[model samples]
Target: MKTFIAVLTIFLLSLQCDRFQFGSNQTKDDQAGAVVTFLQGNIFITTQGKESKAKIGDVIRPGDRIITKLGRVDLQTYRGEVIRIKDNSDVLFRDIAGASRQNTDIHLWTGNLLVKSVKLKSGQNLSVTSPTMVAGVRGTVFSFELEKGSVPKVKVYEGAVSVAFKTSPKLIELNEGLSKENYTRLVKTLEENEVVLEPGEKLEVNPNLNELVYLINAKVATGALTGDELSGFVDFENGLSKVNAIVSPQEKAEVETLVSIPGETIQKQIDSQNADNTDVTTQTIEKEHSEKRIEALNRIASEAEKTGLDNEEEIHSHYSVLETIHKANGEVLSGAVVAQLGDIFIVHSTKGVFQLSVDDIEYVEYRNFKVKTRAKR
Candidate 1:
């Protein structure tokens, strides 16, 4: 009878061990602070060295990294703040809290993000950090962009923000427009060296002069300037031209001479030289002029490509392809594009033919899959 009792006790302990193990696994799965409200087209959630395809209602825990490729995702935290991540973006959720939060830090590696925070409880704050700058806010709506080879750009639509450089400790407070009087007061508060951006204002931060010039040139090439902004860009370009001419006097003289000759004249001279038994000196000059003219044409072509028009053919090739649509209200649909009629898109999806307005869609991404049919005997 004592032997029987010993065996029974051992079995009871084994059951308890199994139960504990199950509970531990359950806790790990339940560790989440936010939910993915909307996502479409190749969104992924990576955590603890494991990655999984993201879907609506997927829980986003702290330390989770969200990546979107040719896609966009909208997430809602438990605290009710909304984060909209644009295509080709990677963001890390450093901290997430729902109850009496202290702080939340979001790290943006690249791409753009739109944040809308209605209000933060007392003692709570949120901040976004990029490679070059950090922006802190209590409760606000703002957008941040981290484009390659450019400094971070921040635009505020509502509420105030404090921005600081990543390489330095200095900070500046930017306030949205409360009233004309209040806006004037906030502007007066800025130090001579500090920058405070008002509502509808945008700022780009760069400490390196060369990088600033490149960033401005990129914006101009992309047609992102207007009105006074366009005028300022023109003036800046003229200044750069002057500086280049001063630094390379000989090159400037050569360029001026080349510019005076008509294209037809240059081509005619080349043709004439090719047709004649020209002397070596004249042949050498002809060759040099031909090379310089080709170089100038190539440069113009390169600049035109930078405007993104050269990729028009590639962009249209995927219009009729099958894709997945992620909607703002947490619905996923699979479809092929039928046609686009004005501001609305006609899609033939699993749910049947539907007309979707661009404003209702979060993102649409082409699905990548292959199917094999039986080979003919």
Candidate 2:
């Protein structure tokens, strides 16, 4: 079977490049790339359609729907957060939902997604619904996805949701297994064996777990950073620190460096570069300063990728062909695609999303979602 071969490989080159440390809640490794975690399910990937039972390292992509044999697909973020996609459903992953920021956001166009967001000062969030409606989070576990049927429906199995009413001053709380009438119209909040949620606690749901949704161990965890996944990894890392106090010294140092003016040498250089030139007024100076700050931030992230696994190995399997298959042997790109089961891979040279038949793309990566952010402190 000329299946999607997920050949994993890693080759770190030594250089006198400027290095930085991992920020709080961020991973120090880049191996994880954009993809945090994935598993084999009844997946379909293609321009329009495809079917296969993906193995260990198959890359998954947007427009791809994964149907688990019995349950659903559980995708964990670096912050130990989870998005459980139920069986027999479809959720269109819109974007990477940036990983390295204070909050990681994943937009699910349609399908069932059980989200266990890792808390941070600016915690992570996963939105799994149409544009009209969205799920907000402030560090907690929850689930939302469209249930299959003649008419697609939205379901939230855990946590409370500030369900926006179609037309009224009424915003109700949709708890676990509490059928939210806003979207699904399957409105039903199981009152039996149910405990009232504390303040800041959203709806409680047990779509698959049955009546008792509170005991499902919805506590989300954090993971290390790896590969180009530094950005998202950083987000998770920071989130962890804020929620609790789980941070490495290296990360602490880096965070400190970001908040301050940084090294004197670079400071002097930047100062001189913009000094005295009245033409470089406050506006210009601030602009240049901001750019440098962002550069410093990228440096911090890049250096962090150099760190170890706490940074898992999910996003380190993509490759950049050397233009020609015969010639481009082992010549990968700066970024890689970590393969999932139904990843519609469009190699740099290929025109469309080609079927990556690599059984085990040992080294694969999915790009992290980009966000508008300040470079550094």
Candidate 3:
């Protein structure tokens, strides 16, 4: 009997440690990707080779792909950055890191995207790549479109973005000893081929030029042009000069204005739903809940700090304080507001991840660490 009791105690301790480690690992993985904030029409997310209709709160991890057909979806990554996947689009979340000086890489196979990126920390990077071209940004609002058989186009609204054709593997395999002089010139030209577009600027990349050596080899085999002539042609075709002119201010506004639609529509929905919430009883209850939420966040923050944990750990600890979201309808949602874009709030709740518009919310009792109340819309 004594031996059995001792063994049971040890077994319980081991199980507890394993449980803790499992929870830790799960949280770390969740921070590595964007979360689906809103979904409309038909959208699918494929993960681990299984595709399912995407729902709010789905985490788009590395290797995951999102397809939107006759629908639109909004995803909020770390620090309030928003990516709006437009209709008839297919995109893959290649990689993401949500830490300070973050890096996010996405592949857009087809369709269009409107991105409202946050101001990036130094060393941060955000990139979108298609089959033939890639666009890199530090911090900017931009639009990216790539349709099959057509050239990829990038349009900048607020900040600068670098657009370039993807380098060819064949170009890298060229023999330096066979023709050192030609090889050196070709490599130098390709290195300088990227174009940077400022605000309101637009550029289209010719996909055929992506494979420099393939083009040159084909031309040479046909005796169409000498290596030297092809080198000049490559330079002319893939030069740093903008292929398309800068869009007009009106056009820039028209493009940039897309970022606001989600927030605006959510507000309209909220206003329509909240029309009956002007009663004294509803106001009283809202005020009480708001006060309680603020108190809960402060207590959580205080307790975590009191435990002598680091800032990052303390932030994680605050997730215990279930946030309250009063929907325009009589329903209430309890979750943590993980990310926000304009007036839309992305909440990680007990039920699931949810994207709620400020207009649809009576109010949000956000975290004390970065606390702010969303006024009743």
Candidate 1 per-residue C-alpha lDDT over 216-235 given as tens digits, one digit per residue, 9 for 90 to 100 = 33454455533333222211
TM-score computed on alpha carbons, candidate 3: 0.52
Pitting candidate 2 against candidate 3, the one with the higher TM-score is 3
Clashes (N, CA, C under 3 Å) per candidate: 0, 84, 2
- Candidate 3, residues 1-377: lDDT per residue as tens digits? 33433443444354334311111222243346665655668999999999999765455766789999988887766444678898899998876645432567778889998887777775556778776666778668888998776777788877888776553333322232224454444445455667888886788544445444335444534545444544443333343456445554234333432332233322223233235332343343334434533443444334333544333333335454446777888787665565443355555554555556778888766544444579888
Best by lDDT: 3
Summarize candidate 2's per-residue lDDT along 1-377 as a digit string, tens digits: 01111100000010001110111233332212122133334644332476665432233333344555543444433334445565655555443232343334344444555555545453334434432233445444444444332121232223443332111111121122222231222111211212322222333333222211111111111222122221111111010000112333232322222221222322233233334322323244334434644554445444434443121122221231122222124633333221222222222222222224343233544444343578886
Per-model TM-score, in order, reads: 0.44, 0.31, 0.52
Q: Which pairs, if any, clash in model 1?
A: none
Cα lDDT of model 1 overall? 0.51
lDDT of 2: 0.32
Off by over 4 Å in 2: 1-41, 45-53, 59-71, 97-111, 148-160, 165-377
Candidate 1, poorest ten consecutive residues by summed lDDT: 236-245
